[model samples]
Target: MKTITKTSLVAAAGMAAALVAGGAVAQTAGIATVQPDAAILSAKAFDAANQQIATTYKTQLDQAASQQTALNTQLRTLLDTNKDGQVSQAELQAAQAPNSAIGNQIRAAQQKAEPQIESLQRPATLAQAYAIEQISQKYDAALRAVVNAKKISIVLTPNAIQYAPPATDVTRDVIAEIDRSTPTVTITPPANWQPQQDTVQLLQQYRQIVAANAQRQAQAAPGAGAAAAPATTGKAPQGR
Candidate 1:
């Protein structure tokens, strides 16, 4: 039997084709994104923007730390939680009620502050966002560019390939396209979309409590530190 070849096509004004060169049991077609991980674009710019956001909310974060201490202290006072060194479920519920209220307040505050932070960080964020959008668009363009330039019908990720005639992967061409477009492009989260200072403050406070507990635990049980590694993770844990 003759092996049939296939091709890949992207909708972003690009075209490509695949050539078959080996005998095979079957052929398959599927769709996959040939794009850079959004999380990897212009790391320095994104990191800077993230650091600024933290700096902007530093004061609030400190306030949150204080409040968390007071709340947990309040919990300690209640039921000793029976002095067992852990709050009773009932006592825990009681203890958390006020914290929950505080959380609501913090959320409200964050809602208030998000806009301001958004304003201050707009230029940097826009630059990053634009860069990513370009990545998505250009990766496809590059694929098409290479395919059209080479006159192939399709291209695939290196992994998708099996035994076949060697052809230019075109991934390099696609990457170049992404670099050209993504770096120059820009995106802004919204001039009005600031994260709330109040919420940030609350988050900071909660974080402080968390840190204090972590430190205490580290002191109490040093081994836990290796596994419970806590970091202010995620300037873009959600995405790049």
Candidate 2:
């Protein structure tokens, strides 16, 4: 995905909405920007798979969440020597001295929990990868069709530019094309099927976007612990 960073840009509509909001740029010649990953995320097939996976893997998902919380707590207790609520990489490194007892305990705990976490997450992970792969198979053709139809001579990612007019962004157009081409994707992967390495990375970015959206929604909900501020600090994970 990174290899296509400039040539093949990506963004979901939710995130792209913010990026595409700026002064209008009037161009006589064809020029545009598209977010490929976001287009895929916004695809109908991807949304359906997300919902299906959440329901089908409810047990594993719940268990994984609980396990992650416990692991974070353990890591904090072991490495947060200064008693900060958060643990830092420097603290972790310092705790893992050549003959440190804390290092041995941390290593042992992580080793034991690592496989358990992986096992619990495997189903949903593979399911997501499969869905992404199914949709992404049509990306090239969809992009090409959009470029030809829109007469876009030069395309760039929103990330590559400081600002651009909303009209200059063809992300939504591309997403529509993707949805039309691959309306629905499957969560069920074939037996012994393995995801391509790129799919796995894309899956991770997808999860990050989902998590960020969830957090944003939670903060915006009434009676929440804290008021949700505008999300300007965190940028969506770039395609890898």
Candidate 3:
């Protein structure tokens, strides 16, 4: 929910058209670029895994989403001092004043909602981790194979350079390798299974990408007004 809201699978790795065209960068002799998260999430296996997860954890996901919506409404009501039905930066900051009564109320509300939401979300989170773990296990070998095949000596993230031709982007190739090597991943974890911190973090990023996509879709919907409010964060609408 943190940085996840701003992440998008297509935008983060490469745009969809570019990916479908096998990525846009032209390859340099000894260098290639990859965006690991993008490649992993874009794989066909990940899509299949997500559908399974949605079904497997439908109850928990529905409950958590409902709770979050209610919480967002409550937070907006508490912070929208002008009664304009919108919580803006100025409104949130006013509510966040040191020892302010509304601040105390808002904090109390969030404190209560946070645990319940997290609890309901746990199942899906774990399921995501389980799927990611399965796919990620094959990532290193897949990457190395691509690197060797291309005779690339150095691999870098998309952000590592100022510019590169689209052909240099190997994200699509890596995704292909992952899909072939790990055609499907299990969403079911052992009863005692717990994800490592890295998996947890990666899943978090994946979720964020999902959220960002949802927001974009919502904004682009037919009836979406120019002034349509952004999705609520269950906290101040802006930094205090």
TM per candidate comes to: 0.34, 0.68, 0.77
Please list the residue runs of candidate 1 whose C-alpha ends up more than 4 Å from where it truly belongs after superposition.
1-33, 36-99, 133-140, 149-151, 156-170, 177-240
Tens digits of per-residue lDDT for model 3, 1-240: 222111232234322222233446445888898888767667777677667766777777777777877776787777776787556777667676899888888878878887777777676666667777777788898899889888988999878989877888887778878888888888888997877666766666665555566668866887653342224332111111
Comparing 1 and 2 on TM-score, the stronger one: 2
Off by over 4 Å in 3: 1-26, 217-240
Q: List model 1 lDDT by residue over 79-127, tens digit each.
A: 3435655434565454337656533443454455444444433343333
C-alpha lDDT (0 to 100) for residue 131 of candidate 2: 87
The segments of candidate 2 whose C-alpha lies over 4 angstroms from its true place after superposition are 1-28, 80-99, 157-166, 210-240
Superposed Cα deviation of residue 50, candidate 2 (Å): 1.0
Error of 1 at 173 (Å): 3.5
- TM-score ranking from best candidate downward: 3, 2, 1
What's the CA error at residue 158 for candidate 3, in Å? 3.1
User: Candidate 1: how many backbone clashes?
Assistant: 26
Model 2 is weakest, by summed lDDT over 10 consecutive residues, at 1-10
Error of 1 at 175 (Å): 0.6
- RMSD, one per candidate, in order: 15.5, 8.4, 5.9
